[model samples]
Target chain A: MRFKWSNVVLFFGYLFLYFPLICIVIYSFNESRFVSTWTGFSFKWYKALISDPIILRATVTSLKVAGVSATASVILGTMAAIIIARWGAFPGNTLFLGAITAPLVMPEVVMGLSLLMLFVGMESFFGWPSRSGNITVIIAHITLTLSYVTLLVQARLQDLDNSIEEAALDLGASPLKVFFVITLPMIAPAIVLGWLLAFVLSLDDVVIASFVAGPGSTTLPMIVFSSLRFGISPEINALATILMTILSIAVIMSAVFIYKDGNIKNM
Target chain B: MYRIEEIIISWFSELMKKIKGRHFLVAIPYGWVFVFFICPCLILIRISLAENLIASPPYTSLIEWISGYMLQIRINLGNYMVLFTDEMYIRGFATSILIAGTSTICCLLMGFPMAYAIARSSEKIRGILLMLVVLPFWTSFLIRVYAWIMLLSPCGFINNLLIRLNLIEAPLQLMNNSCAACIGIIYAYLPFMIFPLYSAIEKIDYTLMEAAYDLGSSPLKAFFSIVVPLAIPGIYAGSALVFVPAIGEFVIPELLGGAQTLTIGRLVWNEFFGNMSWPTAASLSIILLIFVVFPIVFAQRRREAKLSIVD
Candidate 1:
């Protein structure tokens, strides 16, 4: 009885998690203009979503920001992870650690508001970045995503065997060379995972982007959010389905890659 | 390609040689974080103290040089004061805490059994089950929240299905309420609660439970005495994870909740955008930050203490 009861709870939990998402996908194909009622099946909403210029532009912008911010954050976060995990301690290390971890728990509204204020202050003081635009959004995203990447990479680094890098250094390779040839390759998977995480975070962000986005710099989430404000739309459902499909494909591919990599390592 | 790669490597090596590699590695990210993350927080506090102005940037300077020598400081305590006196702000805080707290408990109740089941499953099934839990989290958060809207809205799938079944004459008032907001929070954050609990529970040796059974302890008693005590760390971690974010959640309450559900996050957003009051928003954010920081610090300290005890 206990076994059966636990299974029932697990089943219902999975149902609750996936049911709404499945409903959206099913409704996306519904032919009726009204979202609740189903008349027939159609792909018209998907076609409409494809033709929407605003959404397309926003998608392009989101991709740009996500791509740039993810790459930038990977570099910065890797540095941070190396410093925290490899380097024993340094002056202001506690402060640096605080700065790195602050963004993880800081409320989006707080981060967004403060960053916007800083940009405005900078603009007035330096006359540079005259307006909050894609650049500001990218900066905010890097800050927000950096914590995630750093934590991931730092955890990976801490798990690593120290002797590999030590052996490389003992063999007369410079520290820089050892890091590039040994440590970098070893942590490459974590870095890739971090980059993907950062990318998704930037892509999914709406609250921070809403604050920092300037005129003509609306992101995909921003656009979708604004449309959602009016009520349910079939196009939004179609868009949700597409986004879910892409994410699932990415996740499955990565999972397969990791599984294969693990098998190869075992061999 | 080989020649270009060699050239790039040499160039990078020379650059690294010029700047001490250790400092170079540490300085870049540290400086970026200091400038972007740390400075902005200080800027937030400063902005929160400034009076609202009708200009671009929209706040009066807190410090000014008067008559080339004397410095005048105008620190407005009004913004923070307003948060205390204003009934709307007070209610917003209370409502946010109530909703977040309620959702965290609900998630714990739902997630504990699911996590325990996964931990007890066969190895292969465990991996697949864990993946299923994490898969939804990879999708867009906005889309996930938007999913609830599709289900709970008056003209949504749930309502449509109920009406079609002739179970009710009118569609239930499911959406645009605090209940819907709580459901959205629990739904979105359930995985957060489950992951930590699964890890903690997975670490428990099944032999211990079997021993408890051999000793004739009831299943309920064994679970309460053994499993619950062991899972306290995960419970704390998961609750902190859910409760903190849920407190500041903007989209869930804004979309699913009605006007009565004026969460601190939504209030801050409206103060900034709808009312164009930056200082008020900044102050509210500062207050919200205070509320969030306590739990995080407490959790960190408790985890540290637990680790020391384990050691």
Candidate 2:
């Protein structure tokens, strides 16, 4: 029995999911500052957003944070994946896996506080790196995103056949050469996808950054959050529209890369 | 199956073959977590016993630390005890669980129909419906959540439309409240609930439903008897996935809870920043971790144990 209610119910569900965003997007173009009422449509808020120093600064800061944190996370995550995949369940393997992935499920408050505490310890112990701002933000971002990178890369690596590495070894290639030439090339798509994921996660994080970020390290989310102090602004819609474009591109890119990678071997 | 002796011998050889360069290359990942994730959390577990929140770090020793800063780390269970004694904190945790549980239930109720709809749709329509389910995630989560402030506010669309229809006399108090916050959480997290259930529902052979119909079962009975049982795993899977994070949800509550309600998430946030209670906050963090992780580990292990018996 093809339940005809399925299609009708689904239309309402789809509408529910998108109605709010559509309203906000539409009202962003409204001449009135108030989001509720839609007066005549105008491009004023969008124009004002272009000249807003604070919004621009926040966008720049968020980009930098996402860039730096995503980069570091990629390196750390790739390293973790290679190690875990190459070394079959070592002594600390189980514990290490748990620890790395634990950050994923850990409450943001828990992660934020603990990471801040860690930085405090680092400062006191090392007697340097005193300030907690961009560096700490990047570090914390890496700590959080590392798990995603590792999880993704590990998953991709699991599907790869071991015979390629075995063949390289059988040719009298050293471990370094084998990995650099064979494994690295093979897992390239995963690394790229992992980087993209890490970037997005770093961009999305709010709470952890709140704890670790010091003065002037306000990322985009931090800026949006602070902007809420004065209540909602339509310019927020302009900024949101831009960021949504960037994220959409990033997601589409990841999907393409993953799809290609999956089909690459078959082709 | 291969002979046990041969399998063990080959396993050792294969392991050795794979073990070539033992460089620090492999240590990087584990090492990072060991220091950042494990060490800091363990340090929190040590620091949680402080007498007060503001006793700045370098608590000297573990034993004294627990008892509060008494020239050193003196052991004290006061914080945990206070967590119990303090009505606000106890209430906060309870409320956090309540909000997360209620919203999770709501998510299931809303998500099941949508997921089933998507699963039951024509193959082509299913892809589009599924894409719609996932599309929200492509946008900024915060922005989507912020949309609610506009939707649920006094003059927000929901209230405005309802009033225009003469459904209510005045706008309901919708924004910056618990109910609104739950709505945001459910909406922000609906995609998460839908996909897992979708995958689970998609796995159930349609023939099962067809078989039930052929047996003269009503559609309702077919759902209850055949569909529901097959979907229980998905239900549990999606519920756990959604509920676990909802418990720790911060931004929605912060933006939406206004000042009246305090969740465990906001409580922990204030403990670190607002109250300047680093030790207490750290302790609270450890406690929260313990509470969530302990049950999860036990449940996961029990699942595996039961699965092993089936083999």
Each prediction's TM-score against the native?
0.95, 0.90
Model 2 misplacement above 4 A: A1-3, A260-267, B1-21, B53-73, B125-128, B298-302
Q: Which has the greatest lDDT? A: 1
Question: Candidate 2, residues B165-265: lDDT per residue as tens digits?
Answer: 99999899887778877898899888888988888898889798889889899989999898777787677768777777788888888888787668888
lDDT of 1 by residue, B140-258 (tens): 99899899988888888888889999998899999999999999999989999999999899998878888999999999999998999999999999999999999999999999998
lDDT of 2: 0.79
Q: For residues A1-267, what per-residue lDDT tens digits would candidate 2 score against the true structure? A: 357687678878888898888877788788988755678979998899889888788678778998988888888887888777777778877888888887777888888888787788888899644554588888788989889888877777888898989998999999879878988887788788778878877888888888888887878888888776456778887777777777777776666666666743321
Instruction: Return the top candidate by DockQ.
Output: 1
Q: Candidate 2, residue B119: CA error in Å?
A: 2.7
> What docking grade does candidate 2 earn?
medium
Q: What DockQ does every candidate get?
A: 0.74, 0.62
